[model samples]
Target: MRLTVLGCAGSFPGPEAACSAYLIEADGFRLLVDFGSGSLSALQRYAGLHAVDAILLTHLHCDHMLDACTYVVVRRYAPDGPYPPLPVYAPAGAPDRIATAYNISGESVDDVYTFYGLQPGSFPIGPLQVTVDRVNHPVETYGVRVEHGDRVLTYSSDTAPCEALLRLAQDAHVFLCEASYLDGVDNPPDLHLTGREAGEAATKAGVGRLLLTHLVTAWGSEASTFEAAASSFDGPVEIVRAGARYEV
Candidate 1:
């Protein structure tokens, strides 16, 4: 599996990065993990607008899903005409929420996207095996574990410390985790994880590599986040950068 970090900024777009988005490709199929704010423009640098086969949304937060509305416009009124409706897997009420965000009729958004409600279970997307689990978050959020052949890649969409995340990341080749809070700081409960907590989870899960993402630039420097995560995790740890690609 090939993983590409289209954007990695947390909560909002920073000067140097966008919000949360990733592209995964394997066996000639392309799957997008999230379509966050300013991600569409960045995605164009890697793949065409119509190249994506499917999209999986972790949750309906604006930072993670707002660009999906812009994508609807791109697909609906392209030069050639409307493309086939793309399949989108997301939480319940995603279609309605996106429609409201787009400020258009539901049919308009539905015409461009065929929405599938996500549940806590395993499913197949093309050649990839996907497992979904509920995580610790204020909203109905999910973390995804994807497997292709013998390689496993787990994405912790956005979550605080949770058993479900640890289980999903078990023996993963790559753990794409969110480190939204700094070490030794007070953060709200059930919202986000500190870098140290992320490292602890990576260590406990025995993942091959840990890629820290969803960092808010306002909180601290990327180097500090990497240092905090590396302090706990014994294995390889790095911060995610937009436009960077990794093969697993």
Candidate 2:
């Protein structure tokens, strides 16, 4: 399977940056992990607007999901006649929640997207098998594990260090984790992981690689975050770059 980082900015986007989106492709199927603020534009750099086959939203936070509003418009007004509703797997009430974010009613957005409630379980999206587990976050977030044949890729959408994340990331070829806080800072609990915590999780999970995302540059230097993770994990680790690609 191949993974692409369309965007990785955290909280809010800086100039020319976008927040929290990923593209996972295998067997010609494109499964979008999240479509956050400013991601729609970035997505076009990798694939066509209509190329996405399905979507999986980890949580309802705007920084992680709001650009789905723009996605609705893209499919709803495709030069071709309105296309079939795209499948979207998300938390309960996502239809109403995203519609509200877009200032429209759920019924209107429903025209372009079909909603499926995300629960803790395993399911299939095209050729990929996905397992989701609740993670440590303010909202109802889920960390995901995707399998294509024997390859595995895990994503820690937005979370603090937690057992569920460790289990989901267990033995994954690539652990795409979030490090929103620096190592030596006063950070709130149950919101985000520091680079050290992320690396610790990777070490415990025995993942092949640790790729840190969701970094808010205002908090500290990216190099410092890299140092923090490398201090804990004795494996390939790096601060993920937007538009970077990975094979898992």
Candidate 3:
């Protein structure tokens, strides 16, 4: 399995990074998690806009889902000719909201991408296995555990520290978590996790690697935050950067 960080900023985008987007590939298929700003372009650079096999959305926040609307249009009406509909697995009610947010006719967009609503549990998508767990966020959100063969990767998308997330990521080879706030930078209740909080979750989950993402750019250097998170776990800890790829 291969895990790639497409975008990893929080609240909003950084000067060099986009918002939340991840590319996980296993068994020769690609799955996209969260299509934030510049993600479509990033995917294009990596493997063309049409190379994606499916999309799994965790929430409907602008930075997490907005680019999906744009992607639908491009795939549906691009001058290069239309591509076949890609299956999209997302939280309940996501399709309707995406259609409305982009001012797109449901039929027009629906013809280009088949949308599937996911609940908090396991589901299958072709050669991969997926498990969704509810997470703590302002809106309904999910953390996903994906497995293919002997490899597994879990992602906590914009969530606070929660038992559900810990259980979902248990024993994962890679745990991609969001640390949206610094310990003392105007903490937001029920919406985000601090760097240390993410570390604790990873340690409790017994993951092999802890990859910290969704950083708020205003926090300046994340060196201190990464160091703090590292204190909790003996595994590899990485502060995600765009264009970096990890093979597991």
Highest lDDT: give the candidate number: 1
Where in model 2 is the C-alpha error above 4 Å? Answer: 104-107
The TM-score of candidate 3 is 0.94
Candidate 1: residue 79 Cα off by (Å): 1.3
For candidate 3, the 10 contiguous residues with the lowest summed lDDT are: 104-113
lDDT values for all models: 0.92, 0.91, 0.85
The candidate with the higher lDDT, 1 or 3, is 1
Q: Could you give candidate 2's per-residue lDDT for residues 152-195 as a string of tens digits?
A: 99999999989999999999999999998998878988899998
Residue by residue across 142-213, what tens digits does model 3's lDDT show?
Answer: 999999888889999988888899999899999998877777577868898887898999989999999999
What is the Cα-based TM-score of model 2? 0.97
lDDT of 2: 0.91
User: TM-score: which is higher, 1 or 3?
Assistant: 1
Q: Indicate the worst ten consecutive residues by lDDT in candidate 2.
A: 100-109
lDDT of 1 at 50: 75
Off by over 4 Å in 1: 104-107
TM-score of each: 0.97, 0.97, 0.94
lDDT rank, highest first? 1, 2, 3
